[model samples]
Structures are given as structure tokens and as C-alpha cells.
Target: MPLNKQFNKDVCRNLFAKDSRRLFLKRTLNSATITLAVSSGLLLPIQAIAAWNEVAFAATNLQTAIKSVLGTDLSRASDKISIKIPDIIENGAIVPVTVSSTLKEVSTITLFSEKNTAPLVAQFELDKDCIAFISTRIKMSQTSNVIAIVTARGNNYSARKKVKVTIGGCGD
Candidate 1:
């Protein structure tokens, strides 16, 4: 039962010391493994993706501008995109427009008002991997066609809706 009885005191003491040394070595090795992983770039967190591109802003007409940005013709009506606006904006100081696309792999989305002097209001650049979707506010000179153009995977698509203004909110 007693190691000391079977072996000499010095020998038993040596065996106990050897076991303790092995434990220390094991802990040190484990710590070093973690350090190596971080140094080798295997433990870093990924950065957030920014989806946006700044491209040409040109459109003679709403459709042309939509084409210039998206590179394809839009559907007559699509179930994929939904454009939301007030039936009548009593004030034009700040008109809200919301555009959402159910379509997959959308690259960019833009909004334009046909009647405005400069029809091209805003251009959105979706990063290469971003799906098409956006919401924004645009100015309207009068009751006009507010167009929503979406670019997805190098193809162009869009939707349009006419909104009525009870009062001239665009500082007429």
C-alpha cells in the first residue's frame, strides 16, 4: 500500500516529482496552442459587409434614368417589389417613400420622381453580394410618377406608382 515501503524514500520522492513536472508541461503546451491559432489568423472575426456603389447619375426621363442605372427594362408590374407612399401628402417638406424587393440577389435600388426638373434623385449601390432593397424620401414638384428601380445580378428591374399631393409640399 505504501510506495515508500516497496521502494526507497528517495526513489518514491523522485516518482512524485516526475508526475508534477508532466502536469506543468501539459498546461504550458495547451497555452501555446491557443497563441499559435491567433498568430496564424485563424481566430479573427469577419468585418461587416458594406453594400453600396456610387455610379453615374443621369436620366432624361424616369424610365431612361432607371435604365441608365439598372441596365435593363422593368416589368409592367412585379410582385417582387412594393412601393409605399401616402395617398396625399398634405405637406411636401418631407415626403417618405419605402421600397422593398422580395426578389433574390439584388445588387442596387434607386428612387426617382418623373416630374421633378432633375429626375435623377438618388442612386444606390449594393455591394456585389447584397440583395436588392432600399427605402428613401424624395422630393416631388407636383403629383408625379415615383419610380423604384432595382438592379440585381447585372439585370435591371423596376416598379412605379403615382402619388397625389393635396398641397404643394415641394415649396412650389
Candidate 2:
């Protein structure tokens, strides 16, 4: 190879090596810091995470599931709460759903499929500054009403939409 070409190759190889080393070092330091922090009780482990509602998820009926999750069976229909979902779902395995609310001080959003064996689909906790919106995929056993309950300022506001599932998602 020409002397100039060899020199250029060497320079490029050195630059690549330096970049790799820098990245490796950065990742190592980050891992070490996190390990130390977690060991010293400054950070909690993943297994220590809480706030899972087993009863809600295992509830068989809509009212039971709602009461288990939100501590109230009563909810008022609200125009401010919006549920976006397809009128007809070809496959029940993955139904796209979006729930959003214009209500202020929204704390939580819970989703339920009335026909599912276990009615409670998902629940999300929202921070005060965060937007009252949740987009997720849920499985349906059959054609059913998809309900969204938004908890704001200690009141439950709800909206539901009918979804026709041609093929059951939860093993018909």
C-alpha cells in the first residue's frame, strides 16, 4: 500500500479504538455507580417495586374489577374523557386503544374489557404534571365494550366504546 494510504488507515483505526474505549469506560462507570447506589440503599431494587393490585387484575366481572382497582364501583360518564378504538377489530389479540382526558388533576387511567375473562385490562398512574393520556394494546376475549375510567380530583369519570372482535384474542 502507498505510505499516505497506510497512514490514513492507521489514523482511522486509532480514532475508532479511542471511541470504543471511551464508550466502554462510560458504560462501566455508569454500571458501577448504579451498583454502589443500590447496595448502599440509596436506590431500590427492581424486585422491591410495589403498588401491584392482584385482586383487580384477577377480578372476573366489570364491577368487581373497577371496585378493586379504583376502590369505587360508581363512575359518571364524562364528555371530557375520550376513548379512541376501532369499531371493528379483525383480530382480538392486539386491539389498539387510546384514552385521553381534558380533566385536571388526573391521577389514574384504568382500562377494562367487559367480555374478557378477567375484566381489568390495564391501569396507569399519572403524575400531576403529566398529561391524562394513555395508549396501549389490550387483548379481548370477544366482542365487548372497552371502558376507560379516569380518576381525577377523587372523582371517577368514565367513557366506553363498543368493539366488535371477529377473532377472539384470549383463546376462544
Candidate 3:
């Protein structure tokens, strides 16, 4: 180990080489780790992160969008749910919207444009640790009612605001 000594390739190979026993042990440990992770539910599919509902986003009207998204035709208007948007939007391509709820156990927040070809604009699923708030810019076809639905405690609460658009989105 002297600083002046040249390194020996043969010695290094014998000391640190991937011999048959080492290779087999390494492979077995790796396989066991993977098996333990999957079997114990530490590893999961991508769907657990976020799942898309194609039917809901494809609904063309308010009632149908509600039924498709929430699996129900009824939702009560609630003061606890607050939707913030412009009274008039000069451009409908990017209308800013914010939805927040003071209600407890809020699990999901959905946005809808009442007159859009597909009324459903956005959907969000909030985990237990998340706050009940979402903000995003959505495209609008024309002057329409923007709706926000907050799902909490196995019920849907909603709020709506009318946005007047001077310029149309969705290819005028």
C-alpha cells in the first residue's frame, strides 16, 4: 500500500472480482428484495396515482357531466364551496378558476363548463393529507356557467358562476 508502489491487476481481480458464489448471492438478494416489495404492497401500479374517467370528461351537458363524474344526478348547492372566476373574460381560451372548500373531509374537486362541447373541464382527487383547494385555467367555448363540485362525506356540494366571454374558444 505504499504510494510509490504500482497497482497489481491480479491482486485486485482476486479480491474484488464477481466470482460465481458472489454473483449467485447478489442475484438471489436482489430477487428477494423485489419479491418482498411487491408481495408486501410497497410497490404498486400507476393507476394508484391518478385514474382517468373518460365518460365523465366526454359528457356534453351539466346534468350528464354530473351523473358521469359523480355517479349521481343530484348535488346540493353549498355555501361552503367557493368558486372564483372573472365576471367577464375577454378571451375564453384561458379563463382562470379557483375552487376551495371549508367543508370537512373533502376528497375531490371537479370543474365544469356548462356550455362547452364536453362540459367537464378538470377533475382532481385529493388524498387525506391534502387541502381542499384547486386552481387552474380552463378553456371555454363561449359565455357559460362555470361549475365547481366538491365531494365530501359521501355527498356532492357545488357552486357556479357565469363567465361572459367576448372571444370564443374551441375554434370560434
- The prediction achieving the highest TM-score against the true structure is 2
**What C-alpha lDDT, on a 0 to 100 scale, does residue 35 get in candidate 1?**
76
> What's the CA RMSD of model 2 in angstroms?
10.7
Model 3: how far is 133 from its true place, Å?
0.6
TM-score of each: 0.58, 0.74, 0.71
Model 3, C-alpha of 48: deviation from truth (Å): 8.2
Cα distance off (Å), candidate 1, residue 45: 24
Question: Candidates sorted by TM-score, descending order?
Answer: 2, 3, 1
Model 1, 60-111: lDDT tens per residue?
5655665566565554456688889887776655679988888777776777
Tell me the tens digit of each residue's lDDT in model 2 across 46-119.
Answer: 65886689999999989999998999999999999999999999999999999999999999999999989999
Alpha-carbon lDDT, every model: 0.71, 0.94, 0.88
State how far residue 29 of model 1 sits from its true place (Å). Answer: 56
Clashes of each: 7, 0, 0
After superposition, candidate 3 runs with Cα above 4 Å error = 1-50
lDDT digits (tens) for residues 63-151 of candidate 3: 99889989997889999988889899999998999899999999999899999999999889899788999989999999989999899
Winner by TM-score between candidate 2 and candidate 1 = 2
